[model samples]
Structure formats: C-alpha cells, structure tokens
Target chain A: MIDLSQTISSNTIVYTLDMVGVAACTIAATILAKRLQFDVLGAFFVSFLGSVGGGTLRDLLLNRHPIFWLHDLNYIHFIIGLSLIVQIFYHYVERLDKALRWFDALGLAAFTVIGVESALSRNMSAPIVMLMGVFTAIIGGVFRDIVCRQIPLVLQKEIYITASLVGSVYYLLLLQTGINEWLRSISTLLLIFSVRMLAVYRGWNLPDITLQPKEKQK
Target chain B: MIDLSQTISSNTIVYTLDMVGVAACTIAATILAKRLQFDVLGAFFVSFLGSVGGGTLRDLLLNRHPIFWLHDLNYIHFIIGLSLIVQIFYHYVERLDKALRWFDALGLAAFTVIGVESALSRNMSAPIVMLMGVFTAIIGGVFRDIVCRQIPLVLQKEIYITASLVGSVYYLLLLQTGINEWLRSISTLLLIFSVRMLAVYRGWNLPDITLQPKEKQK
Candidate 1:
C-alpha cells in the first residue's frame, strides 16, 4: 500500500482541491437532509456519510488502514464546520436551488481525478482504475440516496458515471504522456466537470436499457 | 491483519457454515434480481455483491489484505455454482415463499458468528467486535436492498440487528468462561438464529423514531 498520508500531504494542490470536493459533497448532503426535514444529528450523519462513504469503500476495497478521514482529523473537522454553516444558512441555500447541481458536479469531477490518481499510483489495471474512479465519484451519492429512500441518481441520471469514466481514461492517457502532474490533474478535473455540467445543461444521457419484444421471447 | 487463510483452513465447521451463509445471501440476491427483472449480467453482479458485500466491508475495515473471497477461489466458484442452480430452479424457489426468511435468518446468524470470531481472534475491543459482528450480518442485505431500490429491511423491519448484537454479546461473554471453542460458536449461532426466527414469527419490531408534539418544539 502507498503511504497515503505522505503522498496526499505532498500534493498540496490536489489535497486542497480534493477537500473542496468533500466539502461540496457534505454541503449537498446537508441540503438533501434539510429537504427531508432531518434533525441536526441526522443531517450531520448524512453529510458525513456522503463526504466519506465512497472513499471509505475504496480504501476498504484496497485494504488501506485507518481510512483517509481517520488518518487526518482535518477531514472530520472540515465536514463538521461545513455542516454547521449549511444549517445556519439554510434559508439562503434553499433560495439558491442551482447550487446543488453545480457543487455536485464539481465534487464528482474532483473526486474522479483523485480516485484515478489514487488507483493509478497503486499500479492497478486500467479498467479497475477507471471503475475505482467512477466508484469514488458516485458511490457516496448512491449511499446517500439509498438512506433517503430514493433511487441512486448515478444509476439513473443523465451522463453521470460516463463523465467520470471519460475523465479517468483521460487521466490514464495523460499519465502515459508523462506530462506535468499538476497540469494533467487539472486537465482531468476540468474535463469531467465540463462534461458533467454540459450533460446536465443539455440533458445528455446514456441510452437506457429497453426491452425488445422479439428478444424477450428468447 | 490476522492470518485469515490459516484460521479459515483450520476450522472446518465454521468455514463450511460461512460458505452456507454466503450461498444463502447469493440465492436471496438472485431471487431479488429476478423480481426486479434484471438481465443476466445485472443478476450475477447483484448476487456476487450481496454474497460478499458485508464481509468485504468488514475485511476492509479490519485492513485485511486480498479480502476473504479473493484469498479463496472456492467462494467465487460456490457463488457461481449456486447462482446457476437458482436460475434453473427459479420457479421452484418462488413457490417456496417462506424460504427467503428462513435462509436469510440462517445466513445472518452464521455470518455473525464468523464475524465475531474473526474480530475476537484479532483481540479488538469488545464493542468494536460486536459492532463488526452485527455489521457483517446486516451490511450485505443493506447493499442488496439499496441496489434493488427497496428500503433496507435492516433499517426498518423486525428485530434484526438487535438479535445479531445480542448474539455477539453472548459470544463475547462466552470468551470469559473459557469454554470449548466449538461450543461457544454453536451457542452464539443458535442464539441469533432462534432470536431472529422467533422475532419474525412473532411479528416483533424495534420501535421506530416518531416525533412528539412537545419534542418537535424543542
């Protein structure tokens, strides 16, 4: 296993940007919890779960110890601080409806890049790395939606996992090019964010499975 | 960080019983997928996930490498073999309506004991060990329900996690008595299975959260 603390601490830009994504996700969870009329404790739990659920799954699957949040107390404090802020500004946030979409897209993109980098550093296969990237970007939302009793948007929404997969592919290609790491990271993040935003704006979606009458007979 | 291979290979009965639990969960997933009208790939994925999801989480949290299923190829083969059998006997299994509950409870009990033993061997704190035991028992079903878009029964239905928790507590207490290992294991397993079966039969449930008028104001 890579020394995650050393690697993450050394990459100041990526680390900072990744925390921004975590914050975005936590805020989104808080908003969802508010809409669902959850109490303060419930809201905090949802926010914390959404922020770290995917990474927790990833770290667990990868057999990494202490988990990311447990390794660094900063993540927990950041989530708690943001959850409190969301509660305080609840009314203001309710008025800014589009904020959820934007923040969600940003977090999706940022986490995809981070996921790709983490998996790539482990020298996993391309397909596995891409899957891990998409998993990191979407699994948190999946867990949050499930707890909220909604079908996970990632499984049903317009062009969600596709954007993450594309971004991961781009990052892997960038790695082969041996370019500046910072530039590659930024490019991958922007690419996913743009794709996700464009998809939401234009209502792009991967084709859903449609049952064919003739094929069903077989 | 326990030598899972040595432990599992050494215990013939627990190993066999654990596989039965895995098989039961996979069968349950297959039945669920059929109800949801999933394709072959989706059904296989769900079955595989449901069978291993909880144990995967436990192993991950415990920082165990290669994961349990990955460490042993037999698990993969068993799930695949059982899945195929379910596909062939789908209608027969459907006719056996009460089979789901019985199989699920049995699996839950078996997995709980296995989880407790795994954690106990590592000398973890008692509370953590009990939590892990309950977690291993319930997490698979939670994942299965989430993917199938149903509210997880563990979160809503009868005295499920409570039974697992009680059983684990019993196992922990049994450790203090210095009894035979097999006797301790069997007692824990029987205690959980009987509690779950009795609860389902008696229509017992944990009290759900309900807001009172006075509490709401506070």
Candidate 2:
C-alpha cells in the first residue's frame, strides 16, 4: 500500500483563519446593511467590501501578488455563497442582533491575531506591525460605516482598534518571553475578544479628542 | 542681500507635474464634497484624501521612504488653507457648480496622466500602467461617493474610468511615436476631459452587466 504525505503551510492556516473571520464580518455587515434599508446591491457591496477591504489594502501596500481572493478563488466564491444565504433569510439575521454581535467580536479578535502575526512574519517593525494588525482587523467596519454615511466608530474613539493593538502587544510579549506559539496565539485572541466585549458591555469608550478645528469647521 | 541660490533637482519638472496633478485633484474633491453638503470636516477629508491617497498608495507599493506629506508638510497646511477659505465662502462655491464640474474633469484628467507616466517611468508593464492610471484617477471619486452614501459612479457604467483608460492609451501611443512631451500631456488631458464632458452631457452610460441573482457575486 502506498501512502501520501501532506503538510499544511502556516500561510495556509493563516489564510483559512482570515477567510473565517471575513465570512463572519460579511454576515454581520449584511445584517447591518439590511437594517439600514440598503438595497440588494447595497447589501452585497457592504458585505463583500467590509469583509475583504482591509486585507486588500494590506496586500496593496505590501505589493503582494494576486490579492487574497484573486489567489484562492474559493474565498470569493465563499463570500458570494454566504451573501446569498443572508439575502435569503434577511429577516432571520435581523432578529439575531445578539448573535451577530458575538460573532463580530469573535471575528475581530481572530483577525487581529492573524493580521499581527502575518506582519511579524514579514519582519515589519513592531509599531508598523501593530498598526497594520489593528487596521486590518477593523478598517473594514470603518469603511462600511463610511459608505453607509455614518461616522466610523473607530474615529469616534470607541475601544475598537485599541483592543486589537493591545492584543498584538500581548502576542509580541509572549514571543519575547519564549511562550509556546500555540499558547500565545490563543492568548492573543482571548485578550482581544474579552477586551472588546467588555468595552461594549461596560460602555467603556475612548476619550474623543477635538482636532482644534484648525481649518475653521463650518 | 544673502544669495538664495539653489541647485535645481534633475527631476524637478517630473516632481512638479506630479504635485500639480495632486493639487488639482484636491481642489476638485473639495468642491464636490461641498456640493454634496459635507461639512468642513468631511470636505477636508475628501480633499486631502483625494490629493494624497493615490501617491501614498503608489509609494507604499514601492516601499519608498517618507510618504509625500511626511517629506513636505506644506501640503497639510495647504489643505487646511483651502478648507478654511472654502468654508468661509461656502455660498460662493455653492453658486459655481458649472465651474466646479470643469475643475473636476481637469483634476481627473491630470491625475490620469500623472499616474500612467509615473508607472511607466517605474518600468511597469503597459497594462499595469493603464490600470494604475484608471485607479488613481477614479478611486478618490469612488471613495467620496461611497462615503456620501451614494452609489459610486465608476462602479456603475458612468464612463468615468473608461475615459481615463483611453487617455492613458493615447499618452502611451504619443510616447511611442516620439511626439513632443508637452503635446503628449496636453492631448491626453484634453481627450479625457472632452470625452467625460460629452458623456455627462449626453447621459452616456455603460450597460450594467448583471452578476445574476444566483449564489455568486463577490
């Protein structure tokens, strides 16, 4: 009997994690778009764009070849598939705000860990990596809100990007202390998820700073 | 009197054109944002973003040092100045929609030429240069439209990016034929502006291709 051996690349694992996170974001974004009375095309735009927009920005900045979906065509197909499901049962998703919130937090946490680790692997400096991680984790939601004609929660000083930033720092500290890789990843995810959830539940928001109206705001 | 002599940088003309193109885009975006009823903050965001966002994206892709604004802080002040002036005279701007449309067309034309030229200078393939031109010219407007909660004209068949693409082709052909550099640039801009104005006046639009309501759209 002949046996075939296969090894999964760490990149593959990271890619899969990103896909899962994006799927969760897509579902949440579709629900939000519907609640806002976005048309069908608007819902699809919100979902797909909010899901992949950040990673696309990251890839463009890095000059990476074949953007994530362009590479794994399946990822695009997956989003399309998920969008259809949401479209079919729009009422059901609208009624599950609590579930969607939990899923969003989870997805945000997962993407934070994944983005920070990916940047680290590419040898980006800590500050840059942290920014990229946080941006990757939450810029999608910001973009969605912007397109929905609303102020982005991130800009308004919610504890959004801060949670991702803190989680990334924790991951780096663990790496410095020689913690097991698996443990560090889990810890980072938990750290981000808990901080974000607690912030939402406890009404903990970042202090909003005025930009001084340097240009004579009207 | 102290001598104020300075050595002219070899690439002064090239860099000057690039900045000029960016400034034009900034002014046009500010006008559009105003017409759309964006407050001072929103207008500033759209103006500054349209001006710097394209070059920033290009520099990031090339991993160049000192993003354009970082190297020359004047742009920050320039945008502030423009925003202040516009806000104070908001009434005048609102009365100049016809002039603003022409400025918008000019900005689009200028950015299209600059984008393709820069990519070509960097030794990118023609197709890549073409794509860059289209992206640089249209992305800012698309972003502005999206943020205003309006469907982006380019994403539809607005004949926007297509005009830029055609202009890029004309510029490349002019270069291939060894036409005068000034003529090449002017013709390219003229071609695009004329085409865009004609399209807008005639209500010309690209036919919308259905992605089909099947389980696939991403």
Candidate 3:
C-alpha cells in the first residue's frame, strides 16, 4: 500500500480543500438529520459518517493504514465542532439549504479529484481509479441516507455520480496532454461542480429503468 | 499486520464454516431481492453485498490486506453459484424462508466468531474486537437493506447485533478459562445462534428512544 501521510502533509492546497469538503458534507448531513428528527447524538453520528465515510472506504479498499481520520485527529475535532455549531444555530442553518447544496457540489468535485489522485498514486487501473473517485464523491451521502432510512438521491435518478465520473475521466485524459498540474486539477474540479450545479438547476435526471410494464398494455 | 492467510488456510473447519455463512447470507439476500422486485443483475449484486459487506468493512477497518474474498476466489464462485441456483428455483426457494432464517442465524454466529478470532489474532483491544465481531456479522445485511431502500432490521430495534456482541464477549471470556479452542468456538457459536433464534421466536426488541413527547413534539 502507498504511504499517504507524506503525500497528504506535503500538499497544503489539497489538504485545505479536503477539509472544506469534509465540512460541507458534515453540515449537509446535520441538516438531514434534523429533518429526520434525530437527537443531537444521532445528528453528530450521521455528520461524522457523511464527512468521512467515502474517504475511509477508499483508503480501506486501497489497503491504506490508520485511516485518514484516525491518522489526523483534526478531522474528528473539526467534525465535532462543526456539528455542535450547526446544532446550536439550526434555525439559521436550516435556511441555508440552497447555499448548502452549492457547498456540497464544491465538496463533491474536490472529493472526486482527491480520490482519483489517491488511486493514481497507487498505480491502480483506470476503471478502479474512476470508481474510487465516484465512491469518494458520493458514498458518504449514500451512507447518511441509508442510516436515515431514505433512498439515496444519487441512486434515485440523479446525475450526481455521472458528474464525478465525468470529472475523473476528464482528469485522466488531461494527464496525457502534459498540461500544468494545478490547471488540470482546477479545471476538473470546475467541470464537475458546473455539471452538478447545472443538473440541479435544470432538474435533470437519468432515465429510470422500469422493471416491469405497468399493468400489461392493451 | 498479522498474516491471516496461513491461519485461514490451516483451519479447515473455520474455512468451511465461513463459506457456509457466505452461502447463507447470499441466499437470504437473494430472497429479499425477489421480494423487492429486483432484476437478475440486481439480485446478484445484493447477494454479493450481503455475503461480503460485513467482512469487508471489518477487514478494511482492521487494515487487513487483500480482503478476505479477494484472497480466496471460492467465495465469489460459491456466491454466484448459490445465487443462480436460488434464482432458478425461486418458487421452491420462496417456501424455505423459515429454513433460511435459521441458516442466517447460524451464519451470524459463525461470522461473529470468525471476526472475533481475526481481531484477537491481531491483539486488538477488547472493545474493538467485540465491535469487529458485530460488524462482521451484521453489516452485510445492513448493506443489503440499504441498497434495497429499507430500514435495516438491526437498526430497527432488533436483537440481532446484541446477539453478536454477547457472543463476542462470551468468546473473549472463554479465552480466560484456557479452554480448548474448538470447544470455546463452538460454545460461543451456539450461544449466539440460540440468542438470535430465541429473540426471533419471542419477538424480542430493543426499546425505542423517543426524542420528545407526542403532544409537545415539534
């Protein structure tokens, strides 16, 4: 397994962006937990799961040790502090739904890029890398929805995973062009963020697959 | 990290029991998929998740490499073969629900023991070991339920996780007695199986926690 500590510590920009993603995910989850009438403990639990579930799964799949959150205590401290703040100012937080969605889109883009980078560093296959990217971008929300007993929005005709996949593929192709690394990463992030935001704005959805014909056609 | 390959390979009984547990989980998940009106591919997917989800999470959290299923291809082959067989004989398989529940209980017991043993081999702390045992035994079913868009039974006040936790603690205590390994394992397995079966038969449930009073709620 690749040692990620040095890589994670050396990249200040990536580290900062990753924490922003974590904060966004935690806030979104806390809002959902409130909607579900969960207690503070439940909200905190869901927020933690939402913030770290994806990266944790990715790290585990790649056989990385200590897990990211466990390796860095700041992740836990940040999540707890943010969750408590959200809980304290829930009335104000609830009104930030629209803003939260945009933040979540930003998070999704950042997470996808980070996941792709992590997989590429390990020299994983293209398909695996792309999969890790999508997993990192969306699995946290899936986990939060599951615990809240709701069908995950991404699994329910949303274009969310598609955005992550597109960005990951775009990033991979850009690598071949020998472009500036910073520009490549930023462009991929913007592409994903734009796709996700436009999908939400246009109310775009993937066509649903009907398992059986409704009541036998005449 | 402890190399479990040799330990898993040398223990014929444990290996056989683990496969049996996998088969049982797959069959149960297949039955659930049929109820959910999922297609063949969906059923196969759910079965795979149900059979391996818990163990995968346990291995990942413990930083075990290669993952148990990837380490042994028989797990994949067995799950596919069993799932296909169940799908082919859906009508007949549907009648075996009662039998399947018993098999699942047995599987839960076996998986808990296996997880505890794996953690113990690594010298994990007691709480972590016990938590790993429960995660190995139930997370698969949790994943299956989540994918199917249902509230997981274990999270809905069921005694399922309790049985696994009890069995794990029992196994840990049994080690203190310096008993024969086989006897210790078998007794722990029986304890868990009996607890689960009895809970099902008696309709035992954990008490629900209400956040607020109904009249003053919201």
Docking class of 1: incorrect
Worst lDDT run of 10 residues, candidate 3 chain B, spans B206-215
Residue range B47-99, candidate 3, lDDT tens digits: 99999999998887877878988979998889989998999999999998799
Off by over 4 Å in 1: A1-10, A215-218, B1-48, B61-63, B68-139, B146-218
Give the TM-score, chain B only, in order for the candidates: 0.90, 0.79, 0.89
Give lDDT tens digits, candidate 2, residues B110-142.
778877877776676676677568667766666
**Per-residue accuracy of model 2 over A102-138 as CA lDDT, tens digit each:** 7888788888887787678678899878887887888
Clash tally for model 1: 0
Q: Worst lDDT window (10 residues) for model 1 chain B?
A: B37-46
Task: List TM-scores for all candidates, in order.
Answer: 0.61, 0.56, 0.60
List the candidate 2 regions with Cα displacement exceeding 4 Å: A1-8, A22-106, A118-133, A153-218, B1-53, B65-96, B123-131, B138-191, B204-218
Cα-based lDDT at residue B157, candidate 3: 49
lDDT of each: 0.82, 0.73, 0.84
lDDT of 1 by residue, A104-205 (tens): 889999999888777776766776687679778878887888788876656554678788889998998888886977788888888999999999999987
Best by lDDT: 3
Q: Which residue runs of candidate 3 sit more than 4 Å off their true CA positions?
A: A1-48, A58-63, A69-139, A146-218, B1-10, B36-42, B211-218
